[model samples]
Target chain A: MDFFKRQLPTLLVLVLGLGMIIQYYIPTTFSQQVLKNVNLWIQIIAAFTLCIGITSLLRTHYTKIRLQHSGWAYSIILYIVFIAMVILGFYRGIQEGTPFRWLFDYVQTPLSSTTFSLTAFFICSAAYRAFRARTMEATIMLIAAIIVMIGRIPFGDMLSAYLPSFIPGFNDMAGWIFNTPGMAARRAILLGISLGGIATSLRIILGIERSYQGKD
Target chain B: MGIIQKVLNVDRRVIYLIVFLAVAIPIIFPLNLPVTLTEEVMGVYNEIENLPEGSPILIAVDYEPSSSPELNPMTRAILKHCFKKNLRVVTTTIWPTDGSGGSIADKLVEEEARIAGKIRGKDFVNLGFKTGSYAVVIGMGEDFKKTFPKDFNGNVLDKLEILNGTHSNGNSESSLPNAAFSQDARAKKINSLKDFSYMVCIHDDSSVFTWITYGYERYGIKIGTGCTAVMAPGNYPSLQAKQITGIIGGLKGASEYEKLMNYRGEGARGMDSQSVIHVFIIILIFLGNLTYFILERKKTVRG
Candidate 1:
């Protein structure tokens, strides 16, 4: 059982990972064919994973309701909505003008949009409460944020006209900050992430990483 | 208490109420704010503009309804441009669909197609809700037909003439009304990620990374992006690196695009409100810092 669960997955990963890496460099028809098949398999397996994920979510929420956890009412609501959506989806096939589509249009979109829209209010409050220039670094950050905020809107363009021709305008200065310092930092971070990802991938492919099986 | 103390102790509700007013007032009274174009936005516009009519371009609507307010405008503007230029559009969503109104992508795409008088399976197609994110991308890079056997409406991809657009000129196989001769027969032989003239992923999240990493890096496909304002900064590195063609960022970016197209849509209309809120936030930040500094100065004097 240990070998089947542990060794099998590791071996599969090793073979698949090495194969993908090798085929990435190879431009032949056979390599292309392998890549196509592997991608299809990934999609299929991902579909199965989605099923598993839904099942796990249902089980966890069901248990939470059973135990009458602090947020048990929310769990019950979740259960009701989940089941309703599933039933509607299967019954009406999610086509346009269907009951499923109606729920999506009226219920889900509004709820999500309302929730996301509230961020504007919260951000306003947070900026008022937290944005203070106590130190040089904080002041610099504050100035940059202000410039970028102005640049993000058309008002920045209007404001830019008022500034002297020699000095960079709000939008131009903001773009510079974003492209220069911002790009440099983001590039460094992305390079670090890529290197780290490659190392982890190598470890998994070499069978040196078995943490996914709940044993390192 | 003191004025400084009162300023410092201003209620959070007050901030919210003020922001609400700032945003709501603009909506109630139209400002018709002038939108300036950024190079990032202009890059995307120019690329589509320069492409010959009937050129196939992939557009991935990889955002949710929450992002609809911002992202939908970009998608709509791009669609208008593509359809107007007579570009054959192929759309797909790699985002999790089937739950929580994922078909909004389909609805939006179909609406644009309908308005443009473009027929499905010929001028446009939506290969909706594919499961795998990066894997689907890679699969498309290799073979679009194998990746999506059927379109969103369950029509066989084999029957979709839009995918079989000419490599030389990008015209469909059936361009003429009563086709005497179809010289674009080359399209029948080759269809993949690289075959499309360009691809723009209108996304709210990090899916552009997958497109850039796998789709562009591996397949050599040209990619542009219409991303949320916040995400635009994150993608600039990729832009500077020349991985993507251009970026349409946030509502402002969308409005710039709408302006470029000489259309006044939701994006153009919303600029007044968007600008108001941005200026409002900046003012709030400034006022907060001013009160803090004054309070600090007073404390120093007392010491």
Candidate 2:
């Protein structure tokens, strides 16, 4: 039972991981077929996993409701909406001109848009609190942010048009910041992330990372 | 309380109100500020323009409703361009079809195709939302039909005249359509991701990187992307790396694409509002800092 629970899974991962690495280099028809089949299996499994996820979410909320947890009313609302949406989806399908489509177009879309739009308000308040130039680094960050913000808009170009010729344009300065310093910083981060991903992948393949196997 | 204290402790609701007014006033009125096209946006325009007519182009719409406001205009503009150029479009969404993203793509494609007087399944097809994001992309590179056997409408690919030569049972080596004899061009079938002349991915998240890595890196396909303003900066490294051919970033980028198309749309109209909000936020930042410094100075003096 221990072997079935642990050793078998690890063995499968080791074999599949090595096979995938090998398949990338050798592009033979057999290797290509293996990759194709594996991808198809992933798609099928992903579809099933989505259902599992939905079930897990429902179960979690249901437990909260049953236990009468604080803010349990929100769970009720979630259940109501979830059931409504699922029924609508199954009943009419997602085709054009259905109640399902109408619910999505009207309720879900506006709710989502409103939620996302609220971030602008919060960002405004947050920036007001955060952009104070208390230190040299903060001041530099504030200045660069201001420049990039102004330069991205059409008003900046209009303002630049009225400015003197000797001074560089807001757009030009902004472009320089983005192209040189921004790109360099981003590439450095990407390189670090890539190296980290490689290291982690190797650990997972070698079964050194057993976190995904869950607690004993 | 002193003026500095009042300014420093201004109600957040007031800030929200001010932002709302700033965004709303410009939209209600008219500024019609001229938007200068950036090189990145122009790159996307030029690539689509330069593609031969009747060439198949894959468009992956990978954003949900929250980002629809920013990404929808881009999707519409790109579709309009593809149809205007007489290119074949195959659209799929990595985001769930049961969600609003799939419907948005379907409606936008239908609207644009109707405007262009293009026929369904011939000029354009929506393969709808598929599960397995990166895996789906990689699978499409190997075998397109295996990735999507049926489109959103449940129509079989084998029956679609647009995908005539794409079937395994048919002539596999036909050349793509040319402008002169496009009607009879038997070669305009897309069997895999490599078969497409170009690919566009309009997303609100980091899924564009997936397309770059899986679709472009693996198959050597040229790809362009559109992302929300917040996600745009993250794409700069990939853009500099030339992993992506071009980018249309946020509503601003959408407006640029509209300007290049010579068709004024919602994106162009929203620029004035966007400009006003940005300036308003900058002003708030300045005022906040000014008050903070004044208070600090007063405290130091008292000490």
Tens digits of lDDT, candidate 1, B1-303: 898889888988888888888878887887998888889999999988877566788888888888887788889999989877777788888888423424876777789888988887777888888788899988888888888898877789987777766333234454433233323332433368888778999898889999999889988889999998889989998898899989999888999999999987888777888888888888889888888888889999999
Clash counts per candidate, in order, are 0, 1
Superposed model 2: Cα runs more than 4 Å off: B97-101, B165-178, B181-186
Candidate 2 C-alpha lDDT tens digits along A89-161: 8888877888988888898877898899889899899988777898998999899998988888898898898
* lDDT at B289, model 1: 82
Best by lDDT: 2
The C-alpha TM-scores of every prediction are 0.93, 0.95
Give the DockQ (2 decimals) of all models.
0.75, 0.76
Task: State the iRMSD of every prediction, in order shown.
Answer: 1.4, 1.2
**Model 2 Cα lDDT, one tens digit per residue, B228-278:** 887887888888889887889898899899988887787877778888888
Which 10-residue window of candidate 1 chain A scores lowest in summed lDDT?
A207-216
Model 1 per-residue lDDT tens digits across residues A1-216: 878998899899989998888997887999888878888889999989989999999999999999999989999999899899899888877868889888888888878878899999999988888988878998899899999988778888888888889988888889998999988988999899999999999998999987887854
Question: Model 1 off-target regions past 4 Å?
Answer: B97-102, B166-190
